[model samples]
Target: MADRVTVIGWDGSPLTAAACGALGAATLVAGAAHHLALPEVPASAERIRLGSVDLAARRIAGHRGTAVVLADGDPGFFGVVRTLRGPEFGLEVEVVPAVSPVAAAFARAGMPWDDAHVVVAHPRTLRRAVNVCRAHTKVAVLTSPGAGPAELGLLMEGVHRTFVICEELGTDHEQVTVLTSDKAADHTWRDPNVVIVVGGPVGATEGGGWIAGRDPAAGPRGWTRPAQVYGGELGEGERDVLRAAQLARLGPRLGDLVWDIGCGSGAFATEAAAAGAAVIAVDLDPRSCARTEAAARRFGVQLQIVLGTAPHVLENLPEPDVVRIGGGGAAVVSAVADRRPQRIVTHAGTRDAAERVGRDLSEHGYHVECALLQSVDLDTRAWTETERSVAFLLSGELTRS
Candidate 1:
């Protein structure tokens, strides 16, 4: 068999006798700068700092002697294990593990994590990580430099959550602090940190015995509907057709924010919530807002109901990934477009309104398209549902590199 590149996991504690034995025999060792400084590492052995892991792996692959990669927490976890052993490196390896930092963070807080969602907050993955934090009741973020605690806090603005930040776990400089997401944004955080985002106190939210992270059923629904359809801007059958078209274009999912301007019946708002995105339903009418809130409760979903007019109310709400214009005309559409939501879906009872919205959206740099949706057939037979409708839906999406 080929020689194995022994990967050792460290938890800032004294090295085990076996780890020490492996270190003593190793001819080449790789780790972060701090890990290379550990006294257990033999001075005679060549040290490789993982500033560039691929470089270190190349060196290890070329070395004609025993090689070991020292890593924090469990090497087999979201650490260096996969990189060193995968087809890119394809090196044989034996792992000597220690308590993972995530476990250490949860332990320091004295919270259980059997049902917690864990994510890595890196440059490419930070947005999704933040979205996970937003949607889940409990989440643990393995943070990176630019995507650290403060960034997470900022992204989490307008959403209520509790944050537990753990730094330098298992070391003398270790510290654990708990604060609200609002306050977390104001503070600077140390690197090599793990952040736990909790919706509320752990005890109140703990019920995950069989399933992991969030209960799949409770998280979000693949398809969403309101408890009961109230007659409003959209009629009974019309709502379903238009909603399907809007949802398909908007693609609201967990970790997205969908702003519904003049959220007439609250059906669209509830549906977006059911898809796991945070929803902010805005309208000037007190009755509309109340009905939306009621529908949210009945559907067992949540929505931030703002009882005010749009173009002005939207100023205070969090950024949205999608915007649905129900009643507001060109002004509302223009207001939502200014925020640069990835997609915008609006309706018009007339062709003039639709054409006007399409022109406004196009002027604002959106690739626009319009469709006239009408009921072409009606079931005249008694006991069969029938409908008559004609409406225009204009959809716009901003181009991004």
Candidate 2:
């Protein structure tokens, strides 16, 4: 009996005479339940249903006679072959690969997958898979029993991704459905499916050209942006004043995480996100939260928006290196002061709010600096006359005396 390992690929096809002969003489066979059900397994051979990759590897190592390990689709591409032949097992594996599910799914959809980011949405790793879909353009998610279309669809609710659910590939019951993330949530899909997330605008070309093992936008363009060009929904006149005052107070820098409280339209949050710092924008108004999300998408930066009241909402969040309170009351300012950010900036329309925030920072052992800016936009009359209205801008930065 040959004491060697043989890996085989199965695709619901009848086992060839040669394959039957090999399996009939084999001393041990290991595979999933579906693979073990194939008629090719020798009646006398010991069968091990692959429960875990580690257990399967152990069984293969202990086997003395000719052993065959069965795998689904292509074992080389995000499959079981890698785990079986790793250093711990050290067993030589002869790879017999079939058409991978990803390839089959893309083929069924009549789309090219060279640019797709392939990920496995197993129960244990679904969060990372969701994050990949959130951050990347194209993705092929290998879904497991419960991590199928509905779950993935829910995970991708807010992000812009079109789903192509390819179920039961290479089988008689094969089906493919294309839907937006919202519609996918309502539809139940079959198991052993591959979900393709089309990236970019639904009808636009995906990310243009691609590079090997590199993100589409991975190059000289590093993250982060200045406050002036943050590009919120503000009018030209309002934007000018807010941009000037925000830059003067917040003073964002590289690698720093900033919190934008009461982040209306997320202008400050977008600016900080563009600057390469992680940003979280919170607002009580649901519309504002939606607007913030839209602005972040337009700018191609990651800005998390939480729709809720501040102070209470900020309680559970991670500490920030810098905080800018665009709207909130004294309690919100005091709560932010307790976090002791390296810098704290607040825009105040009233003198009382400004004085309260300044005093709170001072009481927290910070040397508070305050500034007020008044700007007026001129309106031309029929005779080319000018009219003006002034708005107060108060900003404060806290530093240790």
Candidate 3:
């Protein structure tokens, strides 16, 4: 018979009959110290404190009798159940779930969270969680010790966000504090907390969304759209064909930050935002910034618009994974290179500018490449044809650390 494992979730509630029975009869119990200390876990059961979950899973798999793994909240929702269910483990599990922390956090705040994007921030991907907060109106960040509210608050300096900080949920020490993102840094928040980053004001309630998260599918249907879609100056922004080529080179993806420098019509910025990347559109012209904001609103995506000159304006923004220099010359290219983005794509209106960018990027330890993207349209009725303007596309990747 397959090894029988019962996964029980404890949400600071009195144990159910099934959970109590499983724990009472467990031959081996694996759980956190807090869970193990619960009176329901029988004295006869051998306890394996959950340090590395892999180690705990191994102990449970090898045990001769019924094994119970205790977890917090719903074990299936971004919790321990997935690790135990892997094929390598060869175990059959029955899960008894209690409330998830995400649900409890929202309940404590007295708001509906059907629309909130829930992201967990570990040491490696903390910036990504912050980026989601920057781009979305509603987010619940499950934070680690080093990646908690203080770190999040620092990143959210200028943004309009209300933080509902819930610490030690479902415990006697549980506390929920409501503060603006700007003010969150002032207090040292306790660990084992969830921060609800609301885009507007604190305690604001939102109507139910059809789908969860800041929906990636909520925006324009396809990319490389016409300039009129963004309401930009006609024939000024990157045309559909050129935009397609640039997108291919830039490669914006989920949980990434993309900078659209000199976002003329907000075309590229909106497209990247729609593709699930947090986007910052920078332009010297106030009109361009306004247009980008309007385009983002029209498409139901978010773009952080900054009206300032390049290099100078790029300083305060969050680090970008990918950058597309739609405008600015060699100086801007060199400045961007200093940031050491994983990938950089620059479009030069002229061949001379392209050559300068390629050379500069190559010197900055990037594998630089250039492509000339040109297209032609034919007039069938008039029996006339004309070649479209040529765009010099320069793309680079970091070659070294």
Candidate 4:
């Protein structure tokens, strides 16, 4: 058992004086092949090739002399330092870190990255990283072997994004290439890469910031919007009271996908987007799509507008955590339910329609609930004006047979 362990971070740069001294004095040194083969690491040190990091940590713990571990940049960040300090190992370790691949990638691109979201995609969870890119304006993905730039580009087909791919950062073979997501997909990318996806209106110089993505602290103050604030006919608009209840039921949050099927005037979709959910508003009527887009802009929210009939159109859209069916019939409800979203909220014009939706949801193993919502507004003349509405709010967990 060495008295203490030293972990040195290498980013293909010359080692610092402290790192050099630690490596020279180390009785046991552990690192990947590249780190072990480095000319600066003293040849006399007992080298342990890093394969299963846990096994290496155990070996370091049992060694009765000073040990040094070499890792890629900023070991504390998605690197080996977490495992070394975890309860399983619990080695009292000193860390000497270098610039992380993430920071290096952004620096090479000459972009201010404080507002960029950073996601790591190993082979198993690449889909989640891609989804984050789909939802946000800017993202940095630290890639794994099989889940490199091409795989990421495949998932970003429809998203408007520019990809800055940095391969083998801080090395002799280092190369940086900028491509569109489509272009990135068509070509084979080198390994040991970092992908930066930038979308929206971020141009050559978007200034600087201190936060990553939208500040969680600065979210929509209030989602309730009066009818007159939106464009188009109020004939198909959802009342603010009903909208509030539906928003609550949907529970839209960051990194969630919400589909507003048959979105009329885009009220529900816009409100959900305001609440930080990635929203898709689908409608058959061109007018409805226009209205939805207008409302999205009016509320300073981003919306993906799909102009088509439901069930058919929804087949190709991204999977949703929550869905609001405002205009479609029972068939539409059935179609959306088939996708197995976490929650579905639909309002109907007739009791038969509401009952049919409830039954359909019940058949899908959802706990169904129906309600008749009404509100009375105080007019300028001190008279009470009343409006009544009915909706079927359904929620269910997927029972995979």
Top model number, lDDT: 3
Q: Which segments of model 3 are wrong by more than 4 Å?
A: 1-3, 200-210, 234-237, 377-387
Local accuracy of candidate 3 as per-residue lDDT tens digits, 1-401: 22589999998999999999988888888998889999999998899999888878877777888899999899999898989988878778999999999999999999888888899988787999988887777899999888999889998766778899999887889999999898887898887899998874221224554677655454446667776676745333377878888898888877789999988888888888777788889999998888888777776676788899998989988899999988787889999999999999877778887888899999999998898887776687886774466788789999976
lDDT ranking from best to worst? 3, 4, 1, 2
What are the per-residue Cα lDDT tens digits for candidate 1 across 91-163?
8888999999999999999998998879899987787788777666688999998999999998887678889
For model 1 the TM-score comes to 0.84
Q: What global local distance difference test value does model 2 have? A: 0.71
Error of 1 at 399 (Å): 3.0
> Candidate 3: lDDT over CA atoms?
0.84
Off by over 4 Å in 2: 12-25, 199-220, 225-401
Q: Which is the winner by TM-score between candidate 2 and candidate 4? A: 4
The sequence of per-residue lDDT tens digits that candidate 4 reaches over residues 235-306 is 433877778878877788866788888888888888887666778889999998999888876655667889
lDDT of candidate 3 at residue 274, scale 0 to 100? 73
Better of 1 and 3 by TM-score: 3
- Ranking of predictions according to TM-score: 3, 4, 1, 2
Q: What is the clash count for each candidate, in the order shown?
A: 1, 5, 0, 1
